[model samples]
Target: MGNFFFVRDYCSISVLPGASLTIGNNVFFNNYSSINCLDNILIGDNSIFGEGVKLYDHNHKYGFNPEFSIDKTDFKTSPIVIGKNCWIGSNTVILKGVNIGDNCVIGAGCVIHKSIPPNTIIKNGQNLIFESLQK
Candidate 1:
């Protein structure tokens, strides 16, 4: 935690044996932002995490019968990789197995899972067709 920039209630995090979270240098995180990387999560440097940004690295597997099985929940692990100099907007949910390239802008209210290419600006309704062009 030396020479790092962070703004949060619990900047230096301490988790149990089963939980994990890793942050890089010059990273900016807003308040109430939570990251649960039970498997493997890696964040690049100079990335901005907006308010209420949630990140998960595991998904529950529910295929067993309710009465016979004693295990209530099962989890599958996936790694989340965020490239350097990225800007994650507010209230965004970054799911597992996502590899975001460098200098990308993740829009607000986005539910992301796919691997986004480098230098791409992903937006909602950025290309809208108002009228048809036909002969």
Candidate 2:
């Protein structure tokens, strides 16, 4: 938690040992959002996150074995950075190794697995589309 950051009720933020989670100033996280940080998660200032948003910086890694079990799999982690003045809609899931630039808007129910450029708008539908904003 950073300066002037506000997290609403029922939000769960977990920072494991040897992991880092940083939320910048004036960031608002709505209800029922969960953040699971296993590597690094940095949220810039003046960002607004809607309800039921999920952010995970790590995933299970199963080796190339035919009989791979979940309990035997290790975790692979990467960093996630959300830039300033961004708006994330409700029920969105942001995965690892994602860097979202400033002034971006992610639509509701988006499953973001790639980096987003600045001044872009992401619309959620059958397919996610990136639309650039002019000025």
Candidate 3:
């Protein structure tokens, strides 16, 4: 644990034997958030993650092949990077290969599966919208 890093109770951080989870200084994670790191999950400094947020760096390979059963299917791994001073709202799910830039705000219940630019704000409802904070 680094300086000023705080993870609330009941938060689950599962890192595979060969994988890495690098969390920077002053990173705060709320309760009940689950981080499943199979490859790498780099969370930058001063980032705040809300409750029930889920971060996953790998996903089951569910391609068209029916030969392998669901449990036998391999996991496709990727890295997830959240930049400095970002705010991830509650119940948000960040998927594999996502690179979120600095000072970004992710609204509640957002399922992020793509990269976001710097100083961006993402709000999710019936639809998701991206607003740039940079002029």
Query: All models: lDDT?
Result: 0.77, 0.94, 0.93
The sequence of per-residue lDDT tens digits that candidate 3 reaches over residues 1-135 is 557989999999999899999998999999999999889999999999999999999988765455745645479999999999999999999999999999999999999999999999999967568999999
Which residue pairs overlap in candidate 3's backbone? none
Off by over 4 Å in 2: 71-73, 127-135
Best by TM-score: 2
For candidate 3, the TM-score is 0.87
Candidate that beats the other on TM-score, 1 or 2, i.e. the better one: 2
Q: Write the per-residue lDDT of candidate 2 for residues 1-135, one digit (tens) a residue.
A: 778989999999999999999899999999999999989999999999999999999998765467855644468899999999999999999999999999999999999999999999998878557998986
* Cα shift from native, residue 108, model 2 (Å): 0.3
Candidate 3 residue 55 C-alpha distance from true site, Å:
0.2
Ranking the candidates on TM-score from highest down gives 2, 3, 1
Candidate 3 C-alpha error for residue 76, in Å: 0.3
Alpha-carbon lDDT of model 1: 0.77
Model 1 CA deviation exceeding 4 Å by range: 9-20, 64-72, 125-135
Model 1, 14-43: lDDT tens digits are: 233666566678988887787876777778
What TM-score, computed on C-alpha atoms, does each candidate reach? Answer: 0.77, 0.88, 0.87
Who is ahead in lDDT, 1 or 2? 2
